[model samples]
Target: MIPLDRFSGHANLYAQYRIDYPPDLYNYLLSFVTERRAAWDCATGNGQVADVLANSFDQVDATDISETQLILAAKKPNIRYQLSQAEQTPFANQTFDLITVAQALHWFTIDAFHQEVRRVAKPGAILAEWGYGLVKLGSDLDAVLLDFYRNRVGPYWDPQRVHIDTSYANLPFPFADVQHNQFTIHRNWTLDRFLNYLRTWSAVRQYIHENEEDPVTDFGEQLKAHWGEGEREIRFPVFFRLGRVMDEPVQ
Candidate 1:
């Protein structure tokens, strides 16, 4: 993957604006494990997944490349936040019972990360990676957002974004695979809140820096027009791929 510093530019925005993982996501992962010894949240931007893992696991190690983002991550007694890359980490081999990557796997060097996961993950360790794509808010609002996403700042998105666009169906997952039904996170938010979330997009930030323009600002009028000046239920479709780490080496 092409390396980029996507989140540091707006670490505070990232912390304040990003949505939460569905509460039941942790339960789905836990179902595969016999023991809740420890879990690693890789590419753990703001410890979103790590925080969830902490509630169940005895210990949670969350790693990210950005110290700025790590600083904003939620603090918990059972969670340890580290400035580390997804492809390389300081943890010892075969140490984790579960490893989850939430919404940030697309930024990783997938093959190398798979190797790192194999090294740190215990035999039969559950490895789950999930991401949410464009939020659905009915056709009227959806069309406006998709126009901005696909045509406005589409060029700025990383190549890995396609994996998310397709719900990670073709992501190179090197493990003994498992299946889970589709998951979606639903929230009710005002148009202002939704716009704040949109402003947190890496592409949106890049567009602002490159062109000195905030497209979302111009788009807001259209959004508010369609949204009808009230709270609306937004659905964030989550795509997940779960697998069990094999006893043998990745090679």
Candidate 2:
């Protein structure tokens, strides 16, 4: 498997600039979960998802491959942070009432991870995995952003990034009720603040490391040229899959 962690070097950037999911998404995920005694947040970067799960569950076990990222993760009394890969874990079988993967699902070897999910999750447990796509600046200023995403730093992005581009539509989810849903992340940010978020992208980090140039600073200039210095509400389109872990083995 390819090294799944690309954000280890910029763990601080991830903790500082990554956008949070919407409340509607949490409500939707929790609605299907009948028993919330214990939950697992796989690939729980920064422990943001686990932090939220801790609010509802008796215990939330969160795991990640990168210790640097986990070190900066959100901490709660009910949350346990551990170093582990997504495809395999140290948790006992039939451990979780709810299993979740936030934006980090694409990093896992899906087939192996799904098998592990089935092994650890209780029968009839709800497994929800979701991720948001490229940020949508207003139509007027988006060109500048797209130029960077598709041109400047595009080649630096990993091949796995295609899954995110299509919003995971083509990714395999061999489970029932794999219902499709869309959620919007609404955030208001000044141009410079938005640039910080862009810096968190794995591709941007790669671009800087490879080329030794700061594209975000240049992109900021392009944006400021278009956007008059003020806060604007930006939206990220979220794609999600919610399924019930079945008793029958996946063929």
Candidate 3:
């Protein structure tokens, strides 16, 4: 299994810099579920998605393997945060009306995670998983950033990172009659803010650890030359898929 503690050191950065799902995307996910009783946000780093679910559901159970990430989770009366793995949770059988994994499904041992989802989800519950791809700045800026991504820090990425690059299309989703939607998560960021966000990338973190230097420091200088001044709208295209959890054996 990938080290669950990888994000622990930078958990604060994740809470501060990670992009949030659009409001309409949350509306779309909630609209499909008839019961708003309970929801699960697996791998709920910083509890971003769980915070939203808390507003709509009676209770939101959020879990992550990283204690530091859980420590930094959003605090709300209805949101219960816990330290747990995605493939095995402490939830009761047939408990949740919805289950969500945002920007995190790719890191899981999916076949095993699917079984646990089956065990906890109520009949006809919705299982939704989504991830965002490469950041889009603009023509010129994108070119620069793409080079930094593919050439500089690319080798540090885990093999499963390919699933996000492909927009989860290549994932072995077992749901019957799967459905999908496209969305964008954007942020207006100053150069400093943008670079700080890049520092939160798992690949970038791995790169810094394996090698004794932070590549983002050097790349930030190059990007600043292109960025000039003022806030730029950074866009991350989101890919989402949802299907009904039914009385079917997990493969």
Candidate 4:
């Protein structure tokens, strides 16, 4: 997992360009929790998930290892931001009605994160761990962008890491009857917004810096040449996995 320190530089761009979870995804997650439930949002970057969680839960506590990210997230009145890592949440045992980890779960140590989640979550609580795949643009121009990610960006991703799987099966959480869902969201973005989003990727940034390939100058040209730039909206698939933590004691 890339360290949180690496994210500090791009935190603002990340908050802007990173796609948000579909509203339906949050509605589905909220269906399992009762009204006014207490929820914890782990690895809550910029409090985006926590902001969504707050709409349903009476109390939402969000924590992240990056203080820089948390600082940007502190604007929300309903969310309590803490500079804490996912492996060691600073909350009491069996206290939360729900625990959520969004795109950031892939960066965590699964064993330790699960243990902490189990310790802090109440009996019958739901653990919703979710992430989205890269946005797909149907045009050939989109193919160029995808190729960049697949060949350049994806190489740094650890194949042995088990966290990328969107499935809840085989997770260390004390849970039963795991389920999954997929949905699509459409967003209208200007060319600048799109390029800014691309620049937020760590691997893309690293590749450009190492090779002296200016991502903005080169990639921007490629995109403009292909798409003949203007404002456009793109639809992308987002995935969610939800599991119920058993009411019974862990064996």
Top candidate on TM-score is 2
How far residue 197's Cα lies from its native spot in candidate 4, in Å, is 0.5
Clashes (backbone N, CA, C under 3 Å), per candidate, total 0, 0, 0, 0
The CA lDDT of each predicted structure is 0.85, 0.89, 0.90, 0.74
Residue range with the least summed lDDT across 10 consecutive positions in model 2: 171-180
Off by over 4 Å in 3: 1-3, 249-251
Displacement of residue 251 (Cα, Å) in model 2 is 6.7
Candidate topping lDDT: 3
Better of 3 and 4 by lDDT: 3
- Better model by TM-score: candidate 3 vs candidate 4: 3
- Model 2 residue 230 lDDT score: 86
**Among all windows of ten consecutive residues in candidate 4, which has the lowest summed lDDT?**
160-169
| Candidate 1 lDDT tens digits, 1-251 | 43566998899988998999776776776888887899998888888778877888899999888899999999999999998888888999999999988898878778898888999999889889888989999866778778989999899777878988988777677678666556888999888888889898888888899999998888888777678778999999988878899975443
True lDDT of residue 235, candidate 4 = 77
Model 1 clash pairs are: none
The Cα error of candidate 3 at residue 81, in Å, is 0.9
Tens-digit lDDT string for candidate 4 (208-250): 6577775566767767765556777777767677777775534
TM-score of each: 0.95, 0.97, 0.96, 0.88
Scanning candidate 1 in windows of ten residues, the lowest lDDT window is 173-182
- State residue 148's C-alpha deviation in candidate 1, in Å: 1.3
Task: Choose 1 or 3, whichever is better by lDDT.
Answer: 3
